[model samples]
Target: MSAEIFDICVIGGGINGCGIARDAVGRGYSVCLAEMNDLASGTSSWSTKLIHGGLRYLEHYEFRLVREALRERELLWANAPHIIRPLRFVLPHHAGLRPAWMLRLGLFLYDHLGGRKLLPPARSLDLHQDPAGKPLKADYVRAFEYSDCWVDDARLVVLNARDAADRGAAIHTRTAVTAARRDGDCWRITLQEKDTGRESEIAARLLVNAGGPWADRVLSLSDQEGGEGEEGHRIRLVQGSHIVVPRLFAHDRCYIFQNTDGRIVFAIPYEGDFTLIGTTDRDYEGDPGDAAITPEETAYLCAAVNDYFRTPVTADQIVWSYAGVRPLYDDGASAAQEATRDYVLRRDGGDGGTPALVNIFGGKLTTYRRLGEAVLDHVEDVLGARGPAWTRRAALPGGDFPVTGFDDLVARLSADHPYLVPTHARRLARLYGTAAWDLLEGGEAALGQHFGADLYAAELRHLVAREWAATGEDVLWRRTKLGLRLSEAEQNAVADAVAELRAALPNRP
Candidate 1:
């Protein structure tokens, strides 16, 4: 088949890919994004779910990465106040770990290194008197509290992709790039739709390999022979996993506990009833797609959390789990935890300056926006004058609502949609932002069968129509995290409803 053409072709639909696509489209570049699986179905969703500079990165003397991430933290918080909120982490200084004074020094630099604005600075805390210390053991008397932001990483990626589509970018999910070859100044690429087995081709002026852990594999498939340019630049795949257990402590604050092995773990309040803990950094040598929390990893995470929390948790206490492989730029670091989280964008063109493929290396959710801007920076010279950077100030889709405060918006929503329960009202406000109005049409009159916990036909219809929610899992997990709250029977009902709906549609894909 003849290939359709675009200005840019972005591979992968994770945070970095979506961010780049969003920025590229907004800046007047025609973009086509191809994802082999669901958006954020990779490491993006499996993040620690916090948008903060790694305090430990400061220990590695990565001042630039930390400052950039810290700066982006506030920017993201201000932009997505509903989904992203400021979180305070209480660090209990254990005797064997880095000395309390050293931690305080690190926090001092963390506060001042980045331009401190809305978020509060770190302060010394006495575990005996401070309320944030009640959960820790008596021996852990001295501690420190620092500020950071928490983001729904999956939603962040989806929102970027949504905005990209809104700005004329074509986002193709369940589409894998089968081949990429250089045809003159453009790249001729073949994409196979995973669901339909239909093949289509697209030509673009530039190609981007943002395949996260699978970046090398994607490069190996590129038109460029043998992935030669990618030889020297190898990505170290590290597996990190998290475990969810019943809430281990009280208070809205999160705990950052230092483990005996020099690694740190977070025990944060998840949803309303669970505590999320984990992240074990282990070297991975297999396929990124098959990465999962093995029994050993699970036991390690459980033991890590059990070491810090006064109330010990075991494998039986784990309610759920997830794992992801981070494609870190290999610096030959001996330990997985020692690997740099900094991202590198390499332009792959010859000495004669042909427009080439840009490959993205390691990056975190906190730095995705900046990373997007940087990717554009690298491509700007190649594209000449594509467009100016506008994402720094632009509001994402559903984030059009003014920054008047989330509570006020929730109250306003509650007042307007009187039928919606407080939880339901808040959930809608948090998920859809200003777009909640779009779903509330027909009000109670249009509402249909309730599958419990704010799952209604009104919202589901809106999701299917606007958010590209193809399957029940899309609605339950990505569009909304209702999967955590929905019962097994309710989940089955959702699957059945979606299946029925798909069957009824004349043009179901």
Candidate 2:
């Protein structure tokens, strides 16, 4: 056990865990976070990659969740403009499902429910005349267009962890929390290093179980006397999967297709070359890590888009697909699609000299900041308040520039690095914002070995040194989606380069 104690120790390195660590540590709390894998390697990275209000959730009457998420869209965009941006979604009217009048009413509420400002309001579209209607079936004559935000989900999680670490929090990647025991006024945490089989211990006044899909399993590891499994806060393991294919449309706007089964699917422009589609929600079992897109899911997604698009999508067209298990707080909703997306926070102990435990369940990417603030409320209740809620207005690392200034940043980056092509500069500016300059330091010669697809040794070094990226998978997939564009030989070279870099660089904690 460490002689020094931390104020809080966070388990899991997903968006929720990283967001809580950032918020708590920013509020003067001494924090330590442990992730069993690379940051955002789990559920966080496998999202449909949108920071939206969940328009379909309105039918479930999740008004509060919708409003909260809707309000957060622009705030989060401003905080991380490099990875998040506004996306207009077109919902074409089907003949039998959701009448046009009802759609208008729902959209009106969606526009007014949250204090939407920077994002444009919902508007009706004449599909016959609008460019958005070009690829859609002729059956759809009218549609509704609404605003949501697209996000680089993995980067968002990493940026939060980066900001937290920059603010003095200890972030431990590839470290698993083996056990947590309440020891009087504090908790003793056992951590096992995955690589070297080394075991160590630390003490914290409070422990936060932000384990997304493994919340129940995490509770099983806790020495809680007489506490029911998960302490009555059972989570429903819901698997949501997405697929990537060659770009289906030429325009920038996304499509939200309504399925006959009452679920919804989104087809958005991704990586400038492919179209991103998916998100099938179904009750999941077994290990969340083992979750993958079933054939039925793939077909369902293809058909979902096929129903709306003039041309059909097929299985062979899919280039990449991923699945994630959402650990939703099970509210006994019969269908997986009907499960509540609202977050629930449950606290234990922290009274009369007892250590505290806060378990977080059921949250989405759009509401991670608010979820962190709520978690801190429980933290403050246990440890007393250290700082006021400050994340709403704060800019995440590399996101200090204006949200609308992305073009200017790209132009400046292109001008500064004459060696960089316009597309490469734009890509860097989109991924790193103002921080691209830091990555491009020492000019063109500094980029070192070219690993294809504009990936370079200097970028890999920066990821290892600053972003806690240990493997090429972390670099290619999470840090940047270069994996989609890089060929097999190029990927193998990147893996080798990352391994060599990790061996040479000082270890990060």
Candidate 3:
């Protein structure tokens, strides 16, 4: 066991865990975080990739959740403008489903419920004359356009972890927490390296179970019991899946389609060439990692889009697909779609000489910052306050520019690195913001080996050294979406390069 004890030890490196670590460390608390896989390798990466107030959630009467998420949209965007940007969503009215007046009322509430600022307000659209109507069916004459934020979901997780690490938090990827038991005023945590199978132990004043889909399993590993029963708090594993297809529309706007089954699906413009359609919510069993999109889900998504688009979307049109299991606090809602998205925090063993443990259940990406703040409230109650709340005004690493300064940053990057093509400059600016200069320090010559698709050694080195990226998937998929554009052979080359790079590291396992 390490003699040095941390103030808090976070079990998972997903959004919630990383976000907590960032907030805590920034507040002057000593923190350590462990992730069994690469950061954002789980549910954080496999999202619908929007930072929006849940518009459909209004039907469920989750006003507080919606309002909080809506307020977070602009705040989060300002904090990480490089990976998040404003997006307009078009909700076409279906005469067979929700009535037009009801839609208008819903839009009114959506616009007024949250403290929406910077983002444009909702407006009714005339599909007959608008460009957004061209790709949709002629029957859809009226639609409502509202603002939401598009996020690089995986990058959001990584940036939070990166910020936490930069703020003096110890982040360990590919490390798992095998066992934890309360030891007087601290929790003795057993950690195992997934690759080497080496075991080590550390102590923390408090332990946080932000395990996401694996929350229940992690709770079982600890000596402490969850509230009430011996089985602990039950988390409903709801699998939400998404698919990538050829771009469905030329416009930048996204579409939200309402299915007859009381579920909603989104079809958004993605990767400059593909349409991102998704999110089927269904009850799931077995390992969360093993969750994959079923054929029925594919057909359902195809039908959902085909219901509105002038051109039909077939299953064959799918270019890529993914599924993620959302570990929701089992509220006994009876239906997976009806399950609440609000988070539940359970704190135990804080007083009477026992160590503290905080179990986080059920949270969404849009409200991750707020979730972190809430978790800190519990932490302060246990560990005592060290610093005041400060994450709201802080900008994440490489995100110091203005929220609306994306174009100016791109133009500046292009001017600085004239050797880079327009597309390359724009991509770098979009991903790294001000840090693009740091990546391109030595000009074009410093880029080193060109793996493929403008992915060079300089960016790879930066991802490895700064972003905790050890594998090609971490770089190609999470850090950047180049996996969609790269050929298999090119991908293999990138993988080989990453392996060689990892092997050459001074601290290689």
| Candidate 2 residue-wise lDDT, 1-509, digit = tens | 37779999999999999999999999999999999999999999999999989898999999999999999998999999999999999999998998999899999999988899899999999999999999998999999999999999999999999999999999999999999998878899999988888999999999999999988778878975323655477789999999999999999999998889999899999999999998999999999999999999999999999999999999999999999999998899999999999999988888998999998889999999999999998899999999889999999888999989888888889889989998899888888888899999999989999999889988998898899888889999999999998999999999998888788875662
Residue-level lDDT tens digits of model 1 in 267-344: 888877798887889999889989899999888887776666677789998878889999998888999999999998
Q: Which model, 1 or 3, shows the larger TM-score?
A: 3
- Per-residue lDDT tens digits for candidate 3, residues 42-81, read 9999999999899988988999999999989999999989
Report lDDT (CA) for all predictions: 0.84, 0.92, 0.91
| Candidates in descending TM-score order | 2, 3, 1
Clashes of each: 0, 0, 0
User: Which 10 consecutive positions of candidate 3 have the poorest summed lDDT?
Assistant: 224-233
Query: Which residue pairs overlap in candidate 3's backbone?
Result: none
RMSD each, Å: 2.0, 1.3, 1.4
How many residue pairs in model 1 have overlapping backbones? 0
Which pairs of residues clash in candidate 2, taking residues 3 or more apart in a chain or in different chains? none
In candidate 2, stretches whose alpha carbon ends up further than 4 angstroms from where it belongs are 225-231
How many clashing pairs does model 3 include? 0
Identify the runs in model 1 with alpha carbons over 4 angstroms from their true place: 1-3, 225-231, 350-355, 402-404, 500-509
